[model samples]
Target chain A: MLDNLQLLFVWAPVMNVQMILDGVFVGAVFALSAYGLALVWGVMNVKNLAQGDFVIMGGYIAYALFHPLHGMGLPTWVIIPILIVVAMAMMFVFGHIVYQLIIKRVIDQDMFTSLLATFGLSLLMQQVINLIFGPEVQIIDSELPILTAFDSFVTIPTVKIVSLVMAMALAVVVVIFMKTSRTGQAIRATAQDPRAARVLGIDTDRVYAFTFSLNAAICGAAGVLVSMIWVIQPFYGIVYSVRSFCDGGGAGQFAGGDRDGVRPRSY
Target chain B: MKFKSLKTMVVSAAVVASVSMAGSAMAKVEGDTITLGSSISLTGKYATNGLHTTRGYDYAIKVINEAGGVKVGGKTYKLAVKYYDDESTPARGAQLAERLIQQDGVEFMLGPYSSGMTKAIAPVSEKFGVPMVEAEGASRSLFTQGYKYLFAVLSTSEQYLSTTIELAAQTTDNPSEIKVAMAFENDPFSLDVREGVVDAAKKYGMKIVIDDKLPADLSDMSATLTKVKALRPDVLIVSGHSKGAATAARQLEEMKVSVPIIGMTHCEAAKIQEKFPKAAQGIMCATQWVEGIPKRDSMFGSASDWNEGFKAEYPSYSSVPYQSAQASAAVLVWKEAFEAANSFDKDAVRDAISAIEMETFYGDIKFSAAGNNIAKPMFMRQIDANGNYNLVVTADDMQFPRKAGY
Candidate 1:
């Protein structure tokens, strides 16, 4: 521990920049994941244990899209952004189906019911993924060059930087959507008080469905970023879910008209 | 209430006993057929290699059955395996092993995909006095346990990456001046691989710059990669099965970790070459069997022939992993043991496996008292520019201090 500390602080302090940059890149992905989990938890009080599987499922979407285009020798930049958009749109639809099928049924139930339902969904998704993909760890090689500084000590993949910027841009788009959009206002009002929102000429069912589906889209976008940066496996969803749970703890506060509560996941 | 529950248990036990007695009517060897049971990792984390193992076993069975089957006691008996998915969990592996033996009436066993799963299943097989010929589980500690019934066909895992240190020492003028960085999963197999690297590093008196066990999730290795950047090590070794191999390969490229010697296990199983073609260049992948090895058996013809046959069977695999090769050899051990023992008795077959010395396409097969293969050698293949593996017998045939992926 002391040796690593010395290496970080004294021996090669320049490496600290690398760590910070890496952390930022990692934090960007977690921010999206946490934001989605928070949305579901804050809006409906439903702990979606299948949140990570949704992310993984979205990554598989990108992977499933990559191979056909890759064979044609299309550029990665074109291929990646297309896949991300397609995954998000598809996950949005998938999310609506899930909402109609599973989440809708348990929306009126207690937290435990929703949690168990999502947990079962998680197991089902993992098995489905394994059956389809054959358990091989997959990654989309963005094929971008690595940018380095400090005589090649602090190296960063161009995709990671692009992912960070994309994450920030997406975060901005989401915040604007939530703050200014009429449907977003309806969703937030429903989250605050479903009964009151329903009484005040708002369709709470549609609001809840939109909110959940929107969260799924965010999770899907994060999954695309994960596929570009880190490798994905069929059963690797649980870790992302665990991290999102910690980040979702703060999401609860963010739900209560407290934007200041939204912060980067510490770990 | 306790007496009433005990009475219910007694009645249940009696019913279970009658069912098992019926199940036992189909013995380990019945009607000119030998039934070998295994609880393999057909799903879960070890599923990739588990599929490879099952394919190997199936291919071996097909070939053996085609070649007039195993002649035992003046009768030819077809070899067949009954498998239950352990789900890559050790607890499930042990429970299934017991079920395979007691309920399914299996007296002979095949090992699971990993050292941990094998560790769990070994004790159950021992307790039941069932003989197991395992191919995949190769932790060195497993060999030290004095297991008479459990026989492993692969080289022990300590040989996995420790040999890379020897190659690293050869790259430098002063072996003692070489620095080693290692990140192994804290599992039974990878930990034992770590010990091998540590032992080799000690032998060369090399400085271990960084020794870290990444989280079992293995989603990231930036923490260790950062340390590697700060303190540039001569050699970086990682072993965490297919997941660890994939994570390390991806992260090293992302981090642009420029170590001279990068050794990893499960490069093929993870399909790192296909996944990260640019990053996979210059990775020293430790393997048990490659395509062109100079070993052959009557059953499988030769090593390359076996590779041709395997790829034909499993069309998806561009490169067959050694896990499958050794698995096929394990089935051969069963066939050879069955014929040699010339009896359906489990103890006789166990003795036959211990006494046998044979040659196979997977290489020479001879077990020491500890039940690990003593004749075979581990091979290191450097991933070439075109994603093909070229065998590196020495430092001369290799690219030392690899080109930075960045």
Candidate 2:
């Protein structure tokens, strides 16, 4: 019994620390993915079931820019910002087109129909990506130096550490934009009470578009970060989608909302 | 005049033999592109296996195409691959098989990482009459299905479980009356593997101490580990997905139990190296393919090139799944057969494929009438401290008849 107690005392904390760190590292990526998903869900009130697919598309974009184009003598770091912008713009157009064609009509319909419809869209998107990319895992170009190691047992990856810093900064920027920018405020107002915002002469349609575009931009950023750390494939979107919902803590809840009651209302 | 006439007659006979050999060579297909289709788990839970296998195929294909593809029947053709994610679901796998056959118009197919998925996709291959070269998953029933279109590159589940048991039974230190315990996930694939282990144990005169199906999604494996510890079996066998496999290993380590774990399919590939790096050491598992197992070159020089290429990719001593590499070789073989048959007709291809003595990456492949390869060999590998598997004993390397018991 005493031996058992000694073993527990020695190993429990070590295991806990490992789990916690893993959770944090995984959770950061989750938070970023969720933020993108939440924006689409919160504003459009139509869950873009294909949100994860868009993330994978962004990763593929980065892969193409890095390789093949490497011969063009463009530095990978310099090309990343341009890739992110292009991914965001492409996804924005994709979302707008998808919403306009199918989701906009079914916004007030049965939730089941919306779910099925978006699911079909997701499948279509997955097939498209598979056709183009051939269902392969494309490796990232970025190589970050290792920051530290504890006798080879606990090594801190330099890329992940940098990603944590970048993620936090990105989060702060998004929060600040939501708090200050007029379009952002209008979108927030619409999310809080669309009927009320509509009465206040703020165009809810435009706000929806702006919110979706913003969500896509965030997703593209998350994809860029992920591409740096792990090999990206066309089907990674589904995993991202699942992890995003996990990090959201609950369905239809906002993790980014502040204490000042500036919460985005979700359907 | 009589001596000159005799010389002319001998020369004519030699020329006739040469013409027959040339005729066979000309029958082999050497098209511009040799299309190989893969229906793999790309999107769902088994994505890791599918992704790695696909990567292996891609890397292998790229290397082959760069070398101007396989030269057979006096022509060179490039390899073009069409692949789809089966989503790790049997239904999806079947659908993908149909799509690959009907839409992609591929000559050969490989993939479906689990046994159930492979079984599901087998019918599609049969229906379209396109030859399929399976990788990773294996079930005895697949070969028993009597389909002419099916050819398995990997060994059957029986071979894997039986090899592990055969290995465990020979442990010198634990030579008490052998008590075997079986813990596996509740799935068709894992169930088939457990059956194989049970059969092996019974055959070897070992007592069944415990046999239980752990839950399919057993995240917390403390209870299972505790039970295993209490049972105190001489040998404990585990089979399932990686998550459960790792959980079992971790819990066992935490409990300070020193029982040797002979693992099943869940611990087969390179992924286990990452999940249970410490526990993986000394844990034995049976597999049809291992990149680490050094073997002599067969009829295929291209197969050796793939081995070199894979070594360059993950120089960190990672275990490359041998079956996927075999599938890449199967693509080359199919090209050879297609050319030999000189027709895309299913029966013609099947006839030609069965007749040819295929020198594949896994070695010489000769199929039985049921389309199952008669010589599908499996290796029993033990993981080293560096998380790489070493082929300690293969079916070929086994000390004949018997060794000291567990």
Which one wins on lDDT? 1
True-contact fraction per candidate equals 0.81, 0.04
Error of 2 at A79 (Å): 23
Q: Cα miss at B183, model 1 (Å)?
A: 1.1
Clashes of 2: 6
Clashing residue pairs, candidate 1? B260-B401, B260-B402
Classified by CAPRI criteria, candidate 1 counts as medium
Candidate 1 structure quality by residue, lDDT tens digits, A194-228:
79889999998898798789889988999999988
Across residues B317-381, which tens digit of lDDT does each residue of candidate 2 receive? 25566645765656655666767887656678778778866556665567777766667577777
TM-score of chain B of each: 0.96, 0.80
Model 2 pairs in collision: A52-A237, B27-B339, B28-B339, B28-B340, B29-B339, B29-B340
Report how far off residue A71 is in candidate 2 (Å).
26
Candidate 1 chain A, which ten residues in sequence have the lowest lDDT sum?
Answer: A258-267
Compute DockQ for each candidate against the true complex.
Answer: 0.70, 0.07
